[model samples]
Target: MNFRRLFAVMLKEMRQMRRDRITLAMIVGIPVMQLVLFGYAINLNLRGLSAGIADQAGTAGARALVMDMVATGVIAPTQTVNTPQELMASLRRGEISVGVVIPPDFERRRIDGREAVQVLVDGSDTVVQSAAVQLAQMPLDNSVALANATGAREVTARQIAVVSFYNPERRSAVNIVPGLIGVILTMTMVLFTGVSIVRERERGNMELLIATPVSRSELMIGKVLPYVGIGLVQTTLVLLLGLWLFKVPVRGSVLDVYVAALLLIVANLTLGLMISTKAQSQFQAMQMSFFVFLPSILLSGFMFPFAGMPRVIQWLAEVLPLTHFLRLIRGVMLRGAGLPELWPDVAALIAFTAVMMTLAISRFRKRLD
Candidate 1:
């Protein structure tokens, strides 16, 4: 090893490395992003979850229990409903994550040494379910906290019946298998659509497309529309496999799932069209897809708690279509939720599809540049 030759080669490599700004940025940026997201955004000690309370008990003791729940920063009251049915309605609307249904005889039963209260937890997100279950008992664990806060005798958290509504058994497969539908769709749809235009350009098909009477909007839509059927077949196969192999049940309305699934599929297909327009070559298209794909995997609540992330990170995730679809997939498979309960996710996906379709049509170039 000659010292001079080694130093000269190192200097030449350094100059090339300096010009590769994207690689340098990714090297530094990816790690920093992982650190920040894993540290600040992934919170295990979740607290202050928004909850709806139906204090049918309507007694000083019931009110005190609510206060204790709030003070512990475990379950913050978002709204108070008069009946348990109303509370369930609030939950289905995604208005709240936790529901407390205190029976009218809660106080009487507590004094009589019997179960009197129930906690309904939204089990769509496994992380939220776990935290909510742990905190549902605070009123019982720290009964002393409410000793002076109310006139009725305090009860133990054990007496509080914690019912995880969606994925009741808290099975890992139950939560993950449904979510995989969205993740897999995002990856395949985006990969195919992203490279479609680039592949056409490379094959000299752009000239043929330009000579055709089809407008840019029609052309783009035609390219992506077929994926809708493919997505349906994939969704059915995956769901059937999950049911048979993993014993993951679709407790929700299957019709609702299919409808929502169709909308979600179209939205993602349009997103791929938009990516196709931006990428000039297959390599560039894949690079762009990874930029979207990696974040979708990390921030979409597919792997972590959407509610557990910091407010800003959660807001950032709103732009990713996968984030919304995960909720729909999970809600359908577990919550047995109908369209009324899933309107927000549907609305978001619709908005995404509309915006991306418009953008793709407008940007789609006719020339092979």
Candidate 2:
């Protein structure tokens, strides 16, 4: 309660705090880092989504409609494909989120006050779908009304057919549940595996393993095989629960889902092995695991729409294994997407796993040194 003593103790604590540079930097730096990251990364404005237009009309009104869509700032005109098939192909490749197919008679109809345009949106993204629908409709009503007002005779207004494929209802669970599988796997698989080799080193067992004849690659694989099976079981349980509890539809082959799941698990596990090598103790391993886990959660499109983020943040999110896996799982579970449709994500996971395994094996040494 003494003021003098309180000041003395405060000064002493301040000195000690200054000496603990890591903790001091963490206190000031971590908050600033997160604030900058979250501030710039979080965006609700779904603007400039890549779009392809199939303007069969090739006329003035049809061109006006496409320009109006771009003016809405929802769908950016990225490609001008000649056929609906080409537009759909771009959608399937995930190249474009919005596809506008102007019918052959679109301009004639708009002139005659009976315009009908087909707008196909990739509904895999709930937020983008909603935004696209809103912006798409905003311009549509004006165009429709204008068509009616400008017509020679009393005629019907333009009609925009907004079709949201993959998730027509815009149900959140249909999008989140599949991504949850990746999130859960990333959390558990990374933390548990992160501690695995570190615990051995801390407990004086790594020395014995080093004395044995096993090579590093062999040792790494041996450690990972058991976790692979565990990963499969965990994936199955989480997926079943999602299906039962959320009625989350599995649109693609169940086998394909698990196949991708297995590959994703291996990728995460390999990254954990790399973390385990640098961590000197179990606590350090856990800290490192979370350091990796935190980014995967926020930036992986697990919680928010990926396209809603700035382009740079989207590229950073691409670095995380969870991002690709979430894409693959969501595509398979919600869109019935096959391997051909999802090969890029599959390839990303494969490349990531290979790189992490190489790093872990290189860093791993059996000796305490």
Candidate 3:
């Protein structure tokens, strides 16, 4: 047995690993990053969901009912509207998660043991819908006080009328399929383009590319353009399978979905190019892509409720391209939202593409370093 030789080889490998700082850092960084994200960022128990109040009753009792709901910690009333239509409009635009509509005949309905408040929920998100449903079943603590104020001895058992919009059936596929597009594109587009330049350098094509008249911008665009078509094809396949197997309906215009998908594809490709520029080898590029992929899947509302995350984590998630794309795809396919309702997300994707493309181009050099 060659114990001395084995020890010498082990020491040599350790020194080589030390020199490859990126690989060494990733070995430690990936696990720590996952632990922090799963512990602090991923939350299933949703709280403080944004809500709008349509207080047609406009009375002390109506206001008291709102306070009682707020005390449940299920929702935070962030906006007041004149009508249920306005409240629903806000929900359609993804501005609020829950809507409270106090009817004009609130006191009569309460005293007569009829339906009183209408709780409108955005049911596209299963977690938020489940919470809203629970809120509906809960008896408000202030109902007794309001009953006494109206000279009624007892309050009706059913005070809130809960209605779930945008997937009343609450199918998981409706939510998952749309977000799946983003996740798939992020994984493939980033990995494909991430290795492109590195593979060229490894295969000795860099000298040939440098000798050509191709500018850095031209090279970057050329690398990603083919992948854009590939991404759209993948998106189509996913959507078709979702519709055929799961019966997930595309309620909005298909063109809008494609537009969002295109922006996401380009953004991810540019991000990959940026990674390729920084990475010294194909292995390092793949590692970086995996790093980006983990956060995009976990923190981008693909697996968890976006509203459930803490405020700071939500703010950090806003920086990811998949976060905005998920909103756009889900809003279009599930909520029947269009350009008017989803312009903010579209703008965000465009801005992300611009920033990533600029960084990728600036960092990429025409010559081998």
Candidate 4:
């Protein structure tokens, strides 16, 4: 209970903390990162969801209805299609979230109280689904009045028909299970590889490794190859559990899912190896992995709708491997999208793997110094 010794110990510990610059930076950086992501980036109240319009009516009424849907601030029309089939194709390719189909008989149908507009929604995302439902229920008296061919007519009936594609049942598992694969792989692969080199250095294995004939690039690849198999195993377990427990459907080819998972696993492993190359200790490696993990989870469209994020945030999110993987997995599992529909995301993952592997190899030195 000597205050003098206790204060001296506290001061010594403070000095030690100050010397660990990475830890010090993380202490300040992690909280600020969380604040910025949650406060500005993670928005649940979604708006400006990309939409496509297939206006077969080719009339003023159809155009007016499109404008009305845009004015709701729920959806923004980004593409014009000749048929609803094209709209669905765009949805499968992850190009748009909502689709507005105005039939050629729009004026006649509205007057006769028949369904005038078919609003097709990509229901794999619940936030977008909720917004589409709201748009369907909105009272568009002005648009309906202006759209009438003869004159302004008031129809006291619902005109928009909302059709939810993919997950018509609106099951959360349908959306979550696919995304869970990416999230789990990101966490495990990154963490496992993040500590590999650091652990070797700590356990006195670096000297033996350096004495071997293996080149730095060879060493890095060797370190990552085993983890790739481990990642694939983990992905299989998660998919099996999701199917058995949640009844999550895999609509696309199972091989496609594995292909996407493989790309993600390699990309994340390379990213972790790159982190390990820079980190001085396993503790620092873990901290850095968490740093990458938080953004991957929050900004990667796993927890929030990608369309809802601010434009700049969306751009930043595009750089994360998880963002693209989620799209690939969800597009495959939920939307039944094929490689033709998901080539862009596949390319992104490949590019990420290349960049990360280059960086990791470049950063690792053969010597312990």
Candidate 5:
């Protein structure tokens, strides 16, 4: 019931938290480090698939098919070889994702109405292969129809250019790395902040902190600052890994990611702080942290594509810090977006942080008695 005693306990808890270096590191350093690694390295869009062709027919008709495939933006034609052996070598060497082997009489058969040319599509990545196969087939079909409609007169093959927009290489790593950053930050900040506060209460040190002259605002800052620093350090380390290992480009301004992540970290920490305010024991806080984490990972578009989810689930995800962070990081990493594009996410986090901190502080009740 004594205000002075409660204040003293808060100060004591602050000192103890400062002394626990590992816990402090997890709170701040981990989130930032994770943001950098997971943000840029993960991508899913496929582009410019390499392909090799073996043109046995050596006729204008076979050449026309190759030309058509090249026109489709999906395949970058590497070499036109005389035999299957040469093209197989290209495929084995990983020079192409697809191999087009034209039989010697391919054009004659098509002209004779025997059968159509066969295309060998690598099925390793069904998504990428299907896209490339579909695009390449367009020229083959056109050539056949043009030849048939013209009635034995040699059809001049049409040269079509396929342009892969956005992510031309279709690498999934680009999407994954950016999204990972948001998830890691959410995990570390929420768990660390909530658990840290609840631990003080469990150890009976909260009473001692409440006894000191340290105000509630000061105590909150003292508890939060160390974790924030840890999150930042984590950000730096992950970014370095992403740059060196994944070869992911930082096309956007570094300050953009930094500002977005900072806001997200603050929101997550504040959410944790709010939960800590409500939890009576460390175990309860841990339970609440897990409760928040499950929904966060599921609803954050990390596992299921956000666009594919039901409208209600998507709406539920809208309020999560991780969801906003994902959009912010992806915009920066993929779109090379600046503050103008990311400001909405930043604003949402700021609003969430403000509300959560206010509620936690108001519920903090300066007097335990």
Candidate 6:
């Protein structure tokens, strides 16, 4: 073996790695972080759903029925409205997932040998809604038992019904694919952009480019555009695979998905640029990108339902760009929601891109200060 040459190469490699310590740490840290975070974070099962009650009966028996429903632990009644219209309005506002209404004749119907009760659910979230509806069925089951006990003719009461709005099929793919678009785009954009910039810096060529008349903003834009193209390609690949292989239906306009992809691609590239700006070496940039990505996949409602997470974790998820991106794509693709419906997500993505790009530029312009 050429020991001298090998030693020289080894020394140079060590120097490069040492300068890019953050990348090294990210490389070591991200995999472990993902393993731990995903293990703990992705929970498909739901608990503690926010429910609304419309108790027009306002009687002791009616209150008792609502209490029985609450005891199931799958749902918690957050408010009581006086009418069904109020409950529906609350659902539109996302104040509650399930709405239960007990008519004024609730108690009288039981006494008069009749049955009347109903449950309304948004059903946008299949897993959680089903769990809420299962709990809401408690009152009807109780009525059945009471009627059997009273020796009355079995009354097949049909007033109680379960309504599922957005994804009535409860298709897992429908719920998952919208969020996956964001996750994959973010990961690909960040990885490619972050690592590519670091490679340029590490190769000692970045100084030459900086010495040129190319302004920092122009240089940054130049560095980001190629990765943006790559991200769009990846987005297209994923969408095609998802549609053809997974057979997940595309319910919304194709333009919506494309628009969402473009925004997310830019945001993720900005995030990657931010990581690269913070990192002195290519490997370090990769590490930070992976670290950011793990929590994104786990907490961004991609693999798990956000409602199932603890309140603190949900709050944590709110800061992540992927969280908002997922909401936008899911709303468009699954619910056929329009810009008015997904405006918050678009606004959040825009803000995140602006902030991340500013940070990245500021850091990149700082001369090792």
Runs in model 6 deviating more than 4 A are 1-44, 52-62, 77-96, 101-115, 122-124, 137-160, 244-247, 250-253, 366-369
Model 1 scores a TM of 0.88
Cα lDDT over the full model 1: 0.80
Tell me the TM-score of each prediction against the true structure. 0.88, 0.88, 0.97, 0.97, 0.58, 0.77
TM-score winner between candidates 1 and 5: 1
Q: Write the per-residue lDDT of candidate 2 for residues 287-312, one digit (tens) a residue.
A: 67767876788888888777778888
Ranking 2 against 5 by lDDT, winner: 2
**Where's the lowest-lDDT run of ten residues in candidate 5?**
157-166
Any runs in candidate 3 off by more than 4 Å, and if so which? none
In the range 1-369, model 4's lDDT, one tens digit per residue, is: 999999999999999999998889899999999999999998888899999999999987777777778888999889999999999999998999999999998888877777788899999988889988888788785675674546635543377889999999999988998999999999999999999999999999999998999999999999999998999998999999999999999999999999999999999999999999999899999999998999999999998888889999999999999999999999998899997788999999999999999999998897788
lDDT per residue (tens digit) for residues 1-49 in model 6: 9999999999999888777667567657767777756676666678778
Report per-prediction Cα RMSD to one decimal: 3.1, 3.6, 1.2, 1.4, 14.9, 4.7
Model 2 regions lying over 4 Å from their true place: 1-29, 140-158
**lDDT for each of the candidates?**
0.80, 0.81, 0.90, 0.90, 0.68, 0.74
The local distance difference test score of model 3 is 0.90
lDDT of 1 by residue, 232-344 (tens): 88889889999899999887788877887788788878888888888767876777777788789889988887777778998999999888888777776776667767788
| Candidate 1 local Cα displacement, residue 299, angstroms | 1.7
Clashing pairs in 1: 140-156, 140-157, 252-336
Clashes of each: 3, 0, 0, 0, 59, 4
Quote the positional error of residue 257 for candidate 4 in Å.
Answer: 0.5
Q: After superposition, how far is residue 130 of candidate 2 from its true place, in Å?
A: 0.8
Predicted structure 4, TM vs. truth: 0.97
Deviation (Å) of 358 in candidate 3: 0.6
Q: Distance (Å) between predicted and true CA of 355, model 1?
A: 0.7
- Which residues of candidate 1, in runs, are more than 4 Å off? 1-25, 139-154
Better of 3 and 6 by lDDT: 3
